[model samples]
Target chain A: MICIKNFLTILVTFFLILSCVLTAQEGKALQEDSKNSLISGSRSLQFRISNNLTLTSFEGAMISAKKHFTSNSALRFGLGLDIRSGQEDYGAVEEDDNLFELELIAQYIYYTSPKAPVNLYLGTGPQFTYNRHVQDRNYEETGEDAAWQYDRSWTIGLLATFGVEWFAIENISFFCEYGASIGYQSRYMESTPYQGYQDQETTQFRLSSQTVDFGLSVYF
Target chain B: MSRLKKSVIAALLLVFGILTGTISGQNDMQTTQDQQPGPQLEHTWSFQAGISEYFTLRNFDMVSLSVKRHFSNKSALRLGTWINFWARETSQSEIKNWDGTNADTEIENRYYFAALSLQYITYLSSGKDVKCYLGIGPRIRFEYWKTTYESKSDALTRLGGDSGEIFAGLQSNLGAEYFFTDNISLIAEYGAILDFWGYSDLYNYKNELSSGFRFSLSPLPVNFGVSIYF
Candidate 1:
């Protein structure tokens, strides 16, 4: 029964979004009489800080290229790099770790206005991410000799986002976004020669993330 | 001939209706073309950090620090990293025999396991706003164990060992994100680790009606974070 109800809710939501898009398109058509313009472009850059710095937080840089096909329609491509560091508290054991991420994104956007200072946009795209991390202490009892070591890995996945940007000042805007992505990662550790035994360990790990972010974008 | 033809036509119609109904139901749930404002390009990037808590049979507490990045618009890619810290407390006990003889035993065990992995992710539509991503890739795991035993006769022994192994497997993640604005969104994800290569190891046990250990160290991870797009 719960599944059925959820299914129905989803169906309704999809239709609602579709209708909104259609209506927005119609509105754009009606405004065509004013001035049908094409080929408008903009570039933007932004930075973000995570709220839970103890777990994860960083400063990142991004560059976006957008092409407007119609007054209110466009497509966008983005590239970004982030460097973050934080501590992991293992209840009884704790370690500080750092990570670096680089990504490339492509998306389709539907905008509410071409000339309006504030516009709403929704987009989804494919992202390729490369991630690497290092830890200070391996969480083991036998001191540094029996401690674990860390390594880096790279993976690919899909990402989606919806948000709005408000141009509070000319060529400058504040934007907020919500998005999620799913991907996989491989992680392993090597043990040094201990006593008379050679030790080895490895495991396959999964990676996924959901986030809400706010930042300032400078457009040129 | 006429009766047989009617029956055949009726069966065909029944099958067609069922198939169409299923397809329409799925389409209705997933079709979001209506939400698209116009033919526009939209790109969003996000990063999330969270802590994971693990519970094993022995009640050892492990802390995990994880980082994730996501891009959403068309096909998506996600990258994440996690480091885990494992710990435990010492136990002491005494037992009595039928003859009134008592035996004292103290056992102390401490260990930690650190794992890292990279995965390729794909999303299966759950609804307009909810989706599940299946991730497959390789993982590296390291385990270090230390044990101390004490007897009533003042005999003490200490032993410790460490092991490292790498395996390839499937990782599954399910989650949902709610968009409050076109650029800002909140998300939650739950992930499961599935091991295939590790199943054949000597320490692997299969109690869940399978060939290998029914359960090994399957990590259940959950994360929440915020995302922004440029």
Candidate 2:
């Protein structure tokens, strides 16, 4: 009975795959006639946002740009920096939380169909991220000493990306991408002002299909 | 054995039927579109939210959101995300048994999880107000959790260490969506995954890493959701 179940599962999965392939080819029908969209020496600016469907609030906003070497290929660079400070107060107690983050990414993108309105693309490059966070708590009437904690970390990695892009008009396009990464992280943490700091290092490998990134680009 | 053979034959026949039906359906749509020239309701942006099986099964513990942009009536790009964050802090006071003094304890815990998915979608068939489409994309996920404890008494004060894990992974999914109305639709999908996890003793700064790969299929139509187009 178990063998039969497994076979049935595989059979159904195969059918699904076949259906996808057949329907995927139908994408050509959606292409609109647009010319000269991808040209050499063209520079484009891209703005990216985390793929949050509700758009309740936006997080991880990144600005990047691309310079086309050829109609089929380009070099892209991105830089991001963010600082946050928050405080909480409860009568005689006060708490503060602060964070600082910076990231840099450089990648090479290759478009498989440069002339088509809908293009499939692949990108690979190096990425680095740094973060610093501090938290503090203070008591006024209780005569307790103020307590603070600090943490810092930096990550360097190589990332591979796959995505699809659609040009709505001659000068504007929207793209969606996913990435996999292998990297290293170094971290330092201090539990309290009096306690000594601890240093740690980690080697990381990740395949993150769940972090779908969405972005728009405009050519100048 | 006889039953197995019969099942295999049935599966093959079903596959044939589906394939032919899909091809003929596309043809029929084209012919209908050509015959009737009406206002095409094509919206470029859509938003969707629903429940998923990967995080938690009961009481809608996991919430998923998705947004799609249609390049044309036949093709589109979709991005979906699931993000959650929770934090708690507690304090307790009790009398020490031996010292007959007040003992105070404080505990803090925090957890976060997020997943993002992207796919290219193509419409295979369409009816008057319904469309059947296929979508495939990559998914990435991250999770983190940490907890710390502190205790103070008359004679001595002790601090408990912190422990947590930072996990990240990638996966690929293939799914299909059916639009029942001009503005509403439903989707179902499955995928293969590769995940990596890092365990840590935060106070001591000790870390360990592990990774694995697997295939996931959440019984058909279970990982389903609704979408609204604008």
Candidate 3:
């Protein structure tokens, strides 16, 4: 819910700024030859930041690229990964932990104003994410039992995105996007200490933006 | 066909139709300008000093200093450095045994980190006062941390250790600079990092070694800084 609120706040702020810009130029014709206009065959590399600002911590970053099929349409693909592992040992206790995560996104984007300095776009894509964590604990004391645990989860979904892009300078643009998703998720957990385990799967329909994506793209 | 299937097909067709219309219209509007922006800043040097996570209003965990030499309007070389130092102290009193006698414990932790990065930056586009650049480079980092615990009442309860790490990695930075003036600009950058780290721990005069790699796919711009050019 907090994520949704932050995304809405940013959305409102963007529209307010957009309205002001429009109001200031209400009577004048916008320059037709924008220095940052898109054309067919254009390609771009982008670094996207996913954050729920002031609500949650910084989520992560994704590297993505886009290839324009036409002046108004494009295809984009993104990839992200994270890995961590650590170990600790004291006189009486020893433990080890590891984590791995991967995410991928592919989208088809249709720009509503490809020729304008500011482009409004609608995109739809399929996304996949997977993560796993494992831990092991051992006690040196007599009659103490060792514990092993692991948790794993994966999700695959389709996402629809609404976004706006502003060309701050020629060949470079800044964008903020919001997304909604419908997907299926599977989770499994096992712990040996108490013989506790869980396995669950479900379908998810989410409209609230889990992440607010802000990105900078350099067009080639 | 099912209603959902029909709808999906119709939507795809509509999108394709719009794409076709726009492509044809673009042919009449003249192709996009291929001309590059006129020469702006070249053969110049710049220096920047800033803090990371500036909005948190917390302790300065990460401080940065960097220098850049522009070879041309389209490219440059930059060397950046960052350092972090953090210390924490805690004192607590607790009951350790069935006799219910109070025991006092003091704990102190210190951490230090430093990194140096060398990058080659390419300007994708520069216009007037705003420009965007892509930088990719190698970085070297060192970290040291120590913790000490003292429990005067219970000798067996005291436990802490020290560790150190060295990291070598490649990082790619995507960022934009908004020039506030001809010589000063504001920068916001996000980095995609790949790191290989080696770790060592010292306990009871024994050393242990561990190694790992980390890769982050997407990230927010944690670095915001101001730069001055000469």
| Fnat for each predicted structure, in order | 0.00, 0.00, 0.11
Give the Å error, residue B106, model 2: 39
Off by over 4 Å in 2: A1-32, A47-62, A85-97, A139-144, A193-215, B1-230
Local distance difference test, per candidate? 0.47, 0.62, 0.69
Better of 2 and 3 by TM-score: 3
Better of 1 and 3 by lDDT: 3
Candidate 1 retains true contacts at a fraction of: 0.00
Candidate 3 lDDT tens digits, B9-62? 655565567556755776655443334343356998988655334334321113
Separate clash counts for every candidate = 80, 14, 7
**Per-residue lDDT for A108-214 in model 2, tens only?**
99999898768889999888999888887778577574777888889888888888888765555778888788787777776664655434444455544437878
| Top candidate, metric TM-score | 3
Candidate 3: pairs in clash: A60-B218, A60-B219, A61-B217, A61-B218, A61-B219, A62-B217, A62-B218
Full candidate order by TM-score, most accurate first:
3, 2, 1
lDDT of 1 at A29: 55
Each model's TM-score? 0.29, 0.37, 0.61
- Please provide, for model 1 over B1-230, each residue's C-alpha lDDT reduced to its tens digit, 9 standing for 90 to 100: 55545554555565567557765875775465545542111344444433222211111112243333444443355554445555665555444544455556665556565665655555443223223344555555555454455556333323333333334445555444434455554444444455533221121121111111222224342344454543
Model 1 residue B166 CA deviation (Å) reads 40
